[model samples]
Target: MAINLVKGQKIDLTKGRSSLSSIMVGLGWDPVETKKSGGFLSGLLGGGGGGADIDCDASVIMLDENGKLKGKENLIYFGNKKSKDGSVVHSGDNLTGEGEGDDETINVDLKRISPSIHRLVFVVNIYNARQKKQDFGMIQNAFIRLVDNQSKEELVHYNLTENYAGKMSLIPGELYRQGNEWKFSAVGEGTMDADIGSIANKYA
Candidate 1:
């Protein structure tokens, strides 16, 4: 089961084995360039003729009890890196305008993780293309959500729409146990031209 988490809650991860069922990590932003093919010359010059586009990847890292990167083999991925037979562990990249399915999902097998695992770290990266110059101008409405497996409840929702000038690190807040449920929330928002490590020092 998953426990509901608010702004400032805590959970003791040393006890039960609450596996992660599903994760929805989303990146939303307004396109600074939205013109989509003005002319061949504009394209050649690399001007603002291309339409709005967002290319990014999201990742979640599970940490051991001592807050270290120990076991990563059990980490799951969705979008563009699911499985060989197309099982869709990680969802495909969403290149269109930001919308409902503009996010990636990663499913984890809780049974594989050690009971001492204490925290989860999420990282997002913006891909750079030839035609488009990556911009960190204005990113809005980005967050991470943890959902329960059995009960299908929204365990935690982390808001990361603030602090645009610098990278944000979201420490899990409001994690606790309610009967058989355990959950937490840690959301952050930011704009970057390259990888997720450019912002969060932890990833670097």
Candidate 2:
């Protein structure tokens, strides 16, 4: 059975696996039917956008052992869809979370990631949450998971439920180096940052 993680939980992705090289990190969600379904958070974070489609964007911020950003190109998202060294790649933007399955994916070649890099933080934010006054309270079934892309084996996954109401951004989880092996953590953290740029500054 696949490991189902709760908030603050952690798991080892390379525990028994010898070759856990390529991984596909996925983030998904469904737009809220109406702000009324959530509550006060909807009032606090909703806008006069008049129920337009929500555009949530998924991104990755690569940090060194010191928690400092490695470089600009390391911020993978819609515009800069791929990392400079070609180790990490984003599958482009997902304007609306209308379809099934993951809305966005970050394909990582752990073997090709820079030796200096020690952590990869997975983040998600509504494309224009600030302008639209939207938040995670307006999204449903939001989750982040890591899978061995080659074997199609799911290593770990976490789904955000009712806790992220007023937040516009989420730090769902992270993949970091533990000794010579790698591990995944279920962070499931919500933030007030309205855009990806602001969230990116935290690591910069």
Total backbone collisions, model 1? 13
Best by TM-score: 2
RMSD of each: 7.5, 2.6
Query: Candidate 1 versus the native: TM-score?
Result: 0.55
**Where is model 2 more than 4 Å wrong at Cα?**
35-51
lDDT for each residue of candidate 1 in 1-204, tens digit (9 for 90 to 100): 444444444544324543553334343344334434566434432465544565655555555555555433323333235422221145555554366533655554344334655555555655653234443332345555655445555555555545443332223232222334544544343443355344333432
lDDT of each: 0.44, 0.84
Q: After best superposition, candidate 1 residue 4: deviation in angstroms?
A: 9.1
**Residue-level lDDT tens digits of model 2 in 1-204:** 579999898888887888888999989998766546356544544543335688998999988899988678878888898887788999988888888999999999998888888999999988777777677777879998788988898877889875587798999999999887888888889999988889888888
Q: Give the lDDT of residue 140 in candidate 2.
A: 78
- Span of 10 residues, lowest total lDDT, candidate 1: 168-177
Q: Following a full C-alpha superposition, what root-mean-square deviation does model 1 have from the true structure?
A: 7.5
